[model samples]
Target: MSEKKKGPYKQTGNIAVDMVAACINHYEKQGRKVAYIRLDFIHWTMFKGYVLEQIPAYDLSNGEIEFDDVIVTQGSSLQVKPLYHELVADGKPKVYLMN
Candidate 1:
């Protein structure tokens, strides 16, 4: 049996950011607005921290990814209402596939 080949989306030191970039690129190519992306607490915290480190003045509500300013509504917006309350109550990670 032959082993499967890995594309450029392979893991890296900053895999989180790389994945986010890829999602953004995909959406942009389709000319569709990215609604949001779900991420676990750890990854979410890391992403936020990374953004702050790079651009201290970045506004979270601007619907733009911190790394490259890719416009997308963060999943947090959706979770902020009853959804977040329910998810937190259940202790489930918020991670999700970016579309």
Candidate 2:
């Protein structure tokens, strides 16, 4: 018999759900709530499909992955990093996924 997979990866067959779940778990451990999620344009092109497909699969009742604001930007690290810092400085709980 096969053993049940642990954590968020197997919770949903969708990889986006699994990634978001893992991110939520990390933020929750730090006593933070994710209100914003940013994906740089290059990665977003590949990732957005998975994310959009899994939006309906999000388990918001658990209150872990509560972010409704998503940002996708096209720019160098110089441009993206500052925006990320600004969000953090403004006390907005955020997750930035970049390559």
Which prediction has the highest lDDT against the true structure?
A: 1
Model 2 weakest lDDT span, ten residues long? 81-90
Stretches > 4 Å off in candidate 2:
1-19, 52-99
Model 2 lDDT, full chain set: 0.43
Against the reference, the lDDT scores of all candidates come to 0.48, 0.43
Model 2 per-residue lDDT at 34: 53
Considering summed lDDT, which 10 consecutive residues are worst modelled in model 1?
81-90
Give the TM-score comparing model 2 with the true structure, all chains together: 0.38
Q: Deviation in angstroms for 61 in model 2?
A: 25
- Tens digit per residue, CA lDDT, model 1, 21-75: 5665565566553445555455566666666676687787754453333333335
Candidate 1's error at 19, in angstroms?
Answer: 1.5
Give TM-scores for every candidate, taking all chains together and pairing residue i with residue i: 0.44, 0.38
Tell me the lDDT of model 2 at 71. Answer: 29
